[model samples]
Target: MDRSFYSRSSLIINTIESTISGDRVFTGNQPDDFALAGLLRNTKTACLLGVGYGGAVRAMLAGDPSIELTLVDNDAALIEFTGNLFARSFPGVAFTSETADAGSHLREHPGCYDVICVDLYSAVGYPRMVLDVGFWHDVREALTENGRVVVNAWGLPEQLSPLAPPSPQHAVAQAMLAVWQDLSHLPCRRNTTFVAPALTPADLRPPVDDASTRLSYEDHLTLGLIRLRGASAPVLLRGGIGDAGQPAPTSRRAIDAEMHARWPGLVEAVTGRAEASADFRAALSERKLTDAATERLLLEGSPAASFAPCIASAKAQLGELSMAWYGEWLCDEWFRLKALDPDWFRMSALWQAVCMARTPLGAVWPWEARLYDMLSAELLDAGFADAGV
Candidate 1:
């Protein structure tokens, strides 16, 4: 087949010509990519996982100038390379890329995306973490209200082997099922390029498969749906919607108080400021963490070499532009500190600073609690603390 012929819409056949030359030689877009573009057509803010060759990026940009894209990949080199490429290619498009583990990224930056597209893959298949229920839980938390997570996977769901034997396909379906179950309370739909057990032929209509293309969209792709909820989950989500009893309070102070109550000793460990502490007493008349004294104290200490810029960016109060600059500083510091040694105490202080900078109101965010839980898990794993059973 010619190089153009190798550009199959379904990507079902991996031809030698296509394999050697790769998608770069393809003339037209794959139908799956087109469908992905369609899914993102109305999306103003989007998070894309596994930005392999910018196929989906191209499709996403084809829609509108209003699109704000955050492309993430675990590969740093790939992130830098594609980030620069897209910055140059789509000059007007608001785009950014980060080299991060998707699960870790979602956990740290919660409730940020309008649409999250998961297409992560490895040589063996999807990465082990991508199949994790925890990853989906994080994804669920990170999505905005009215947001939808469309996972791109191969094969039909029911046709895959069941959970008992744990085949690769089974694992993929299980992950999708977790997503489906998590959003079961909301509206959900699973779409496949080929006819799957989940969808009927009648549901397959119109532009999804034009007469010109006549391609089997069902066999090519499977999208798992998880509709975002407008209201936050219960004050405590044990692990993705389990035991969600009480309604979360609407007020900021109430939320902060609830967090403090749920995780005792957390504020002191995280912020280094306890209500009974001398520092807390001194700040009784102030805004506490956001006060000038706290900022001065943070800068007074010798921080990591990479953290100097973050310390430099700290101001008593900031204007809009300065606030944006401060945010950039915090993002940079978070990445740098995360890469550094596991000095839990030092890291906790730095992490708290980043969290405070990110949230101006001083109300603890979901990500903050998640971060503490992550640190606690690491500490427990390292034999530093009680298993707390």
Candidate 2:
């Protein structure tokens, strides 16, 4: 592993990358950092496990300077470096750095923290304790009555297509679910941040007067709330469709039928609207018409006449980019119709499009990400009939 540090604005970003793979093993100040900070808004004392460059520490302090944080890591040098850096950056915040294994620290200090963040990772992957049910029990025991535990687990399959082979994160998620009641996981790109016992929207709201942190807090809270929708239960439960304990969908028809049963007429209506818009655009291109001429032609005879209501309803409901992506998905689906698995087409296509449209800077537009979450929630629901632990 190789470590590097950089300064951005007022924050110092510490990153560790894999020497062999050259991929980031840990990086501070990501979206997940802000999300965790929002969760810790009202917390007084918190413990961070696997203090990789103190990203969470910086974020939590930024959100609530009064938070007393304890950083635990087995690496003495890393702990010392982080401790010294924070001592300079935040002159008077209450925090401590201890060089110790996270599990041992948790066992020694049961019921000691208001919030506990588990972010143990290495160049190889998540440590064995992360996937151990017994470790999770220790985590539960360490929390106060109303205390919350958030685990930063990576390599989770996307929520929309939950059929991938289970990763280490899946095992950790399973372990957490087994140990804690009301656990919920929020998927952000390839990482899924798991919190337990479940949090409500009100629990994640930003402080009224903290305008500087408001946008980041709200963005994360929006994702958190979207994950709370009832339809997200299955993906949350199994960590994807075919993990160890959950049964697969059986067949494409079964998956499609389930989707229709959950949200009747929604898929049909949206697809129809997209198809209508695509046809209208094709006609305009064929005629080589200006906007004025297109309006005159529409007055003569509407190209999307049959789907007028669907088009109008979709336009009213979806944002302009969302509608455009919806049409783009429809066009791609047409070519894939013969080879498409219904589940893949119905659930994953639009999601893949959203992922592809992410900005050059690697950030998804907030509204587009919200649209994906809303659409995904409507397309799938709980009750995977043979899919229980």
Candidate 3:
């Protein structure tokens, strides 16, 4: 089968056609994947822990023709599917696929790959082993000097409503805390890709010089890019450990506070108004207002109108169904549904709602503190690392 044929999958091609018709588009997801491919510009060896849709594999080949790749996946069928696809797809590129656990493979071939792509996840969530600090330690041992480990953490708010309170039970939250905890000592930089609607396939055509990648892979790239729009950026948790691997703080409260400090104006606008803080404190102590009344006051009361724009942008970008369930679903139920829908704008709006719903009494509704982290990553990726607000 011609590799280009694979990009014709209905799952993504239809999205491209729809997006192109509307022309409502943004940067899409390739920049980050392209950046990842760029990491192997001169490298000869790379390893992928999960095959997913084989986007990273295509990326590595596109960047460097001679690079050798070892792809490990737990599922035998996926291994066969992608393995056969890559075999026929890029004959010139050295390739290997193993049917085994990623951790097991890393342990067997320690200090082997120049780039280790850790994207291991099942439909339910990230595997429990990915959360193990010891597994990360194994990852560290498996890297060559100057090598990089990129772990895929889905920070997108597809399944959880932003209206819900943050909890440790969420799988992504747990994985993030674990990643920082295990790799805190290592020098690292976080990179994020914001979820956006698909762009026209014409915008992402493969290089003309590489006839091998033409038609065949460009569609896949286009599809992969859009699919990733809803995913959290993978963090390059690289470099040497400091202070004997002093742990990074993973407390939800501490993280939220840090996020508030970084983008105070946005946080205030989304969560509460400048003057509303006084009213919130009063409402908590006076005990005169019911919780429902207080929530109404915070969300629709004085100065609440200021956040309407944020909510509007979120709704317009995220769609109605994505936002409607914000304050309605329970924690786990919301997580399950959000994963199926995965809308960034909707999540952003609901996050503001979550913030606005707050009282001095304490967090009552469900919300993801990681929302701040996700938004922060998006801002950073868009070159706002030094953004004043």
Candidate 4:
């Protein structure tokens, strides 16, 4: 897709036959070009459900011109527009265009595509069908043996509301998890491309022949892949859709109490190991005197004070470590501690912290402030933030 198709302006709206069709309102950066390029990599045949200006089709064709592409959209005007645009832009590539409902098309054609890209969205938001579990079941049944489904989903809510109905993005994610073997997310600032049967970062490369397409794919991977499973997956998926899990704490004291109860031995489990590590002790000893003094004030003699200094010193020595460092460290700790207390570690504050830390700097989408708030509550209750550590 060309740069013009990827609109930076979120306010731009396009209509087909007086029906609101395309806009960046709920789905920011709809038809994520780089994300589509990554998902369609190495695919022989692909079906694109929603054709908005043919950006996704252009991207898929650009990556691999020989792909047997199929375009399905409810709007005849869009299919015609895309056909005309492609005639001028990509005269050599051939693709079948069908005017039909996405769900009906998937039901009619089963196990035909190596890759199915679902970018279905109405003017209001994701249509009711996209949120239904039965719809995802149909999507799963339609996939080839090793087929992958890539969805352009709205960004997930930072913190799920227990009382509120799940957002379209969250509902879709949970539904996919229920039906698919695995689910992974390629998150951007606004829209997140969700992939079923989780793909790794290594799988996000473009065809070697297309240098520009390769560059675009590489740029999108900077944020990295978010595997949605274990604690990282939303709690609502515990017993499928209507189960909200536990109610979120409404007050500060209640939230702290919940955190303390959730991870009873978190501080001791993580920090004890850190304190015992000779490398951490050596690193702390080598810190500059001024820096050590500042960190000591930050530590303030908490239980984790000894090892927290090591983290501070490491940050100071390394200049500025990306949040990836913290994310990786958190994951390692979670795995190590989970064996001892599986229930305690599952869906605990640590995972929330990991999610927050791993998010690319400056790319955090709207409604994500709650992630930071949750992490803060954990740190405070665990005595890390209270001591300024």
C-alpha TM-scores of all predictions: 0.38, 0.53, 0.43, 0.49
lDDT for model 1 comes to 0.38
Cα lDDT computed for each candidate against the true fold: 0.38, 0.47, 0.39, 0.47
**Can you write out model 3's per-residue Cα lDDT over 1-389, one digit (the tens) per residue?**
23432332222211211111011111122222432432332455788787764545655554344567788988888788666654654343457889998888989988887667676654454466765767876776777765655555432222222111232122332333343432211001111221111122222222223423432222323223322332333222222111212322224444344334434433333334333444433322232222223234334432222233233223423333223234332232334434433332222323334322221112323343433334344334533332101
In model 1, what lDDT does residue 2 have?
18
Winning model by TM-score: 2
User: What C-alpha lDDT does candidate 3 achieve relative to the native structure?
Assistant: 0.39
Two-way lDDT contest, 2 vs 3, winner: 2
Clashes of 2: 1
lDDT of 4 at 271: 31
Alpha-carbon runs more than 4 Å astray in model 2: 1-14, 17-34, 37-42, 92-94, 157-165, 213-389
lDDT of 1 by residue, 1-389 (tens): 11221232332213211111122221121223323322332456778787765545644433233457788888887677666644544333357888888888888878887667676654344455755778877887887765667555432111111111223333444554555533211111111211111222222222222212221121111110000011111111123323223332223344334434533332233235323444432332333332333344344332222122223222211212222333333343443434443332232333333323332223323343344344444334433332111
Model 2: per-residue lDDT, tens digit, 178-256? Answer: 8765566544433556777766545653322332232232232232322232123223543332355543222334434
Give candidate 4 regions above 4 Å deviation: 1-30, 33-42, 155-165, 201-206, 210-242, 245-389
* TM-score of model 4 (CA atoms): 0.49
Listed per candidate, the RMSD to the true structure in angstroms reads 21.6, 14.0, 14.6, 14.3
Report the candidate with higher TM-score, 1 versus 4.
4
